[model samples]
Target chain A: MSTGPYNYSYIFKYIIIGDMGVGKSCLLHQFTEKKFMADCPHTIGVEFGTRIIEVSGQKIKLQIWDTAGQERFRAVTRSYYRGAAGALMVYDITRRSTYNHLSSWLTDTRNLTNPSTVIFLIGNKCDLEGQRDVTYEEASKFAEENGLLFVEASAKTGDNVEEAFLETAKKIYQSIQDGRLDLNAAESGVQHKPSQPGRNNLSNDQQANKDNCAC
Target chain B: MACLWSNSNEVLIQIPLTEEIDNVTFYQISVKVGEIKWNVKHRYSEFYNLHNQLITDHGVSKDILPSKKVIGNKSEPFIENRRKALEKYVQKIFIFLRQTMPKIFVDFLDFHLYDIYFLLQDLSLLCFTKGDLILSSSRVYSFKPIELYAINEFLKSPAPNFTNSSKQLDLGPILDLCSQLDAFIIHGCYNDYLKSNIILNKLPIDLSPFKIQKGLYLSNVSLDMVTSLGNARETVTTLEVVFSNVKRISDILQCDILHKNTLEESQKWKVLETLDLSNNNLMDIDESINLAKNLKHLILDNNYISTVSDLTQLPNLENLSIENNLITVCNDLHRKIGNIKTLNLSLNNIVTGKGFYKLYSLETLNLSSNKITNIEELECLGRLPCLEYLVLNGNNVSSSIDYRVKVLEFFGERAADIYLDNEKPSEAELDKVSILSALRIVKEGKTPDLSMNGSS
Candidate 1:
């Protein structure tokens, strides 16, 4: 394993979901790679990315799954929602259809994910001011009514992209600290890395299993 | 300045019609990025896969490309259509490659071996001399690679200009020059690909093999071992592991996952204080709720609870949300939630305020979207000393007899805390309301008949 010198104590699993063409992949790319990918092709089954982020002085690795937003792909994508700690429900600000489909997306998320999953509604493509079809206030009100954290972010400009991902991580971390999220639950989407470095030199198979357990 | 520099944004991708065997046209594409030209001969299906992969990996919008067809897809006309689409697709891909400058795409190009071999085959064909294949000579070679043949075809085509700054070029020497440049560039590209493969094999962090697992047992702990291993271990940071679409405890607790008296329940619900029994088929809270000793917030929204009788047993309950239920009356509800700070009973059948008079510590209450038609219900709510905020929107009582002023006068000094229809009475609005109340008291010697106009 190429883990850096400092040991990470936890790994958070996240899933990005929305209707097709809402920039879920772009948002993931922006958060993971810190660059806006303008012409990102549609996600097929699922795409994955990881970044080690710090929250409350803790270095947390975010394992994000970017799922295909196409409706037919939902059968394949639905399975990925099982252990997500956070779900970024995105909608394109330029397209009302994406926003209108939020409830359906939310239903899937709420139905499939654990109750403690932190769902953050993202109004993407905020950079396209002229083409905006959804207002921030309306989306925020929708978020408030649905009990979701809301933010207007532009993946192209990288505006609030960092905050959206980081905020979800922070909320999940808070839940862990508050003990709302059970670390040992099979589907809690949280893994507590036991702080024992002495037993780190185990056989390769055991070491691999230990690492997989931390995902 | 950025707009003026568009002319310098050079892209040189070679598309050659490599074959026409059995009427299935194949294009050998050599896409040049910097000094390395990645060459690949692909049929339409491979192009489709490439396009789809590009879309998935990069999130590129597919709006500009032609829609795919399934009927008669293998016919010559359809193949020709796909070939045209492929040309546009490659151009767009190059455009994206130029703009994003992603290292992964470059690696992806190098990783696919057939493209490199195709380019090498074209180079060796041009080399003519057998010994020169092994010769590490940097000298310029002869005929331009077959990949550039498509560029000449494009130049000869009668299509409209793809770019604004279009210029005509002499094809003869350009082809020669491109061919000569291909020898050294092709050699260098192959070397880099081989060298990187060696380095990649040597590295301890190749995680592609063990990363993907289909079963939940395998996926539960699988890390993006690639990124995690590469990340520097600075401070032992805390990680939040979220499994996707795991059955929530609400369903799991009521059904299969956790059995009673298992090690699972104690651990899972150890610090679980709030339990959401909302939108379930629950008729009422049973004795099972008493098990949650530390439970404070209990949400039973959208259920079938008819009364607040079952809630009295929750020893430490503070916030209760039982909205969208069949609750018709709340007679002495305070006896059950006397110390509760917040209560939400919206979207219910609550018709009277008889149960709320004694909730002295309750600060916030939501009674919206109910059948409350009796203005007298405000008196029961007004008596609660700690009641700071209240919502009664969508109730029949709200549309009766100056509802805001009447409610404000009833709340007295706490009128400023009243939230009617989500609108809190401002200081000025409340002051006016109180003055009107004082005038009415002085003029009439009693409160106005604030009852519903006719019914109830």
Candidate 2:
């Protein structure tokens, strides 16, 4: 029995959220397809995409859900926040309103999702330098104050887009390396893999997976 | 910061009844057990009827039940005393029910009588799998048809068939609806029992790759392949290719290294996206890679590719990693890689930066361990409008006097922003660099002019 390609060690669920036109869907598209969709339509409820990435010599599959940014859409999008391993809080650099709405979004994310959810703040549309309204300093400060990973990215030019996604995965992988995130927690957004012949001891969740299997 | 569900060992204590009329005295109670709060109100006759039913059916005691006082029944103190007594009585009944009738009593406590019925008339228009669903509970007691539909369809249904004749239903939309109601119940109303628990435990059934195998094997396959599957489905695109020592580039392109008959194979390297031709004896690729038009990332690390002759043929090429190559001079790398964003030319013998002059869209450039001597060599990179990140470590220019300042000056405004060695220059560092570079530039220019004047 060949295990085939569905053999990822862990599945990390991610939710991308922000104000309208902040490039939440565009970031997901660029990371997954490596192409900029200029005329990409706005997401209504939630859009799903998956990309397999390698971090610290470990392959992680990212199940990313790009959510709608409209104010009314939060009712539908809030549910997607729970159990997320990573939450990419996107905001348009060209619009101060989007950046201003960061606290409310953070509040919803903090309230609904588990504490282990890696909250990554993204200043999108970095390529639109001429129309830039939000500075890197302020965004970084807000992220630091709120205890979030921060990066300025461009979905169009694909600048720091991969890093935004990969860095989150790297942090999540580091959490797995450290025992900070409990794999046994149902909403921890992490699944421990069973040990095999060539399995390494780096991942300490082998015993956890074995015990879960007994359930 | 707790997870969605907390292990606070919560139990519904005193449910105060609120409201009163002719024969029915009302009780309004707020039962809070940790984060979960249930605000319930019931009339006197309702409790009386339940007490009567319990006595008739289960032969339970009426001693714990608060007796209805006849004197000063409408007075404030009398009503207050009755409310307290009723709360204690309800708590005793719930405690008794916890040991005797757990499921039925819990189910009974979850329902409210003043039901708000909403129309599911737009059910046909709602596309669940398409994820076009939008449901909000912020309207303040406004009816949410989607939440009502979810409760009616999935949670309230006897046995829900979350699938069609062929494929199973996608649980994303359902979960979205469930969590919305759950959040509303927690923060907003606290009256309606958000039937999210049923969906929470049941939705994972659809995600089980092994058809509801309770102990689904995790990490059964290579983590590498799992990610590969995410990018390229087994039936569609090719994700990775690892082959070595090709006499001709066409040998690997024809899939001869992996499979024998290339022509017979319908998917003959057409879907091949990631081509890792590392540790090979390849000198140059001359436009034959046009077969894989969809190739986005091409890795030629540890090869003898002295010059990437014609990578421009692959229109979709965005990433080209040719590290550890023998390229002495990169003349037209930008010409061939018009769309290339990340170029890893580490450990190469590149002396000049003449090749990167036309790379206007380059964001990340890695030219580490090269023979770049002068800062003027990196001046060509200034033309790159989108160059936000660069790594020139191990180069002679890196150790030159005021290297960071010179680099920052060369890139101008972006110097302070770009990440060098995986770190953005701090605000203080940027300020210092700008000041130092200004002094250095003025000093160098003024000395050169004075020396010319003295010589004249």
Candidate 3:
């Protein structure tokens, strides 16, 4: 048997959604690019990023879609909701409107994506503790009430940011291992790779294609 | 000039000029005359005449030969006869005007220019009415100045003739188009046609509302749409069916709207996990839970469900809440949900007894707002190796249960070690007489040696 970093074994599709100014784009940037973009313009339709991460000794590639936050743009961005393996339901800790709109956002996430999609509720901008509009206790209780995995994270400070993405990936990876998420299904948003020779060359070709197209 | 009259059979008369009038003016006057005569001098003195011509001439009528014309040709005998009649009536009026007034007739040529101008104006107004009729009937009028002027006048005038000019824009077609495109971004109030019709039926199965992207909000949807979505099994993952009066999930199970191969090709529904079907009028919970196999968390709060038997077989369920139901007992609940970590049975009528004894792995239990009146039954839960936080607020135990101190004393050491409520018992609170008395009983009696054995 031959092995060279074991070409990606699992591919997880993630979707980030929330109200405007909730820093969904920032959280995505911090997780995929590992750097904070302070002056990043708001998303117009949907932005995509991919990164290969190792979890449980398995190389998993996360395909994340960052969507526009405007209500009218939901028509254009909603198509990205299909085939998601993980969904980050983000809310701004400093804005109660963003917190209060969680149920509406949760309803959307529930109605659109597949059943295996891992929903992680993230209270973003946790560094703005002074202007906190939603108490951690209350948000945590809400997360419990809604049956969502929750955490208070800051993209600017990188606190719990990595944990949120990694936790979603771990949950998806676990689902694949458990056979709950079938890799052969069309909309499962997962692709399973069998251990084989010359798989790296095939992946490099795919990476090159990915570099050519901005999905 | 002379007056001419037509008889019933074939009599006719014509006017004749007395003097050889050179360059004479011809005046045409139309009058509505009857047996009762009204004064006409004041209205038409400038053109009317009574003392001009005194001559009459009659000619024998000639029958013309019929020409060989096409059957549909207008230049035939009948049309020619009607035209001759019209010319005779005009000539008679002109002759009568010349006969009535000699001086007025002499000056008529000078002021005759004014009559021709007014006659052309009347003809133009008549043409405008005809144009209006054509435009309204055919709707093919060119954008000419005259047509545009008439349309503007019709729009501005508050006449009832042009009713319904302010037609409402129909939204049914737009909604139908959006549904055909598989777009589910519904917002704002559409027209009545779109509001009542269920366009979800026409949408493709793959892009139906059940297959909509996650994190979408759909308000004011009908029961038909909800049922259509519920019937969509493998494609729909995370769904929050709210606001509508959905009484039974079985209504959704009957639609068979999902692709048959969706579940077999299980990768199609890989992303769906959480489903919130709360605040409905559901009395049974079996059908909704059976849709998604990978469902992890289920919230059935604020329903009329009296039993939890339907939720027993969900293997991956971690967080389950049947709070505010009418459940009176927790029979076989622990065995059914051996893997569940959080269970909320609050706001029910459960009595503190052996019903809650076997939840061995429960981490947090909320039994608040129940009629539990004693803490003795809580000793059964002490056997649960993982019980960490327990909310007994709003129950009758705080007031009627005198053994609260005794129950806390029995598990106080373990409870404090687990950091229950994030605090250790204070010295004064632990030294209370009620708690000390229970501790003395445990020390004197065999109490099963219930101390930490480092086995959990």
lDDT of 3 by residue, B143-186 (tens): 22122222223234343221223322122332222223221333
The weakest ten consecutive residues by lDDT in model 3 chain B span: B35-44
Ranking by lDDT: 2, 1, 3
Deviation from native of the Cα of residue B238 in model 2, angstroms: 49
**Candidates in descending TM-score order:** 3, 1, 2
Which stretches of candidate 2 lie above 4 Å from their native place?
A1-4, A195-215, B1-456
Q: Looking at candidate 2, what is the lDDT of residue B433?
A: 68
What is the C-alpha lDDT profile of model 2 across B354-443, one tens digit per residue?
A: 778756446789999999998988888865655778898899989998777677666654465578767787776678766765677687
What is the lDDT, from 0 to 100, of the residue B342 in candidate 3?
A: 72
Error of 3 at B404 (Å): 5.6
lDDT of each residue in A73-142, candidate 1, tens digit only: 6655665676789999999999999999999999989987899999999999998999888998899999
What is each predicted model's overall lDDT from 0 to 1? Answer: 0.61, 0.61, 0.55
| Local error of candidate 2 at residue A195 (angstroms) | 5.7
Q: What RMSD does each model have against the real structure?
A: 31.0, 29.2, 28.5
Q: Every model's DockQ, to 2 decimals?
A: 0.01, 0.01, 0.02
Worst 10 residues of 1 chain B by lDDT: B210-219
lDDT winner, 1 or 2: 2
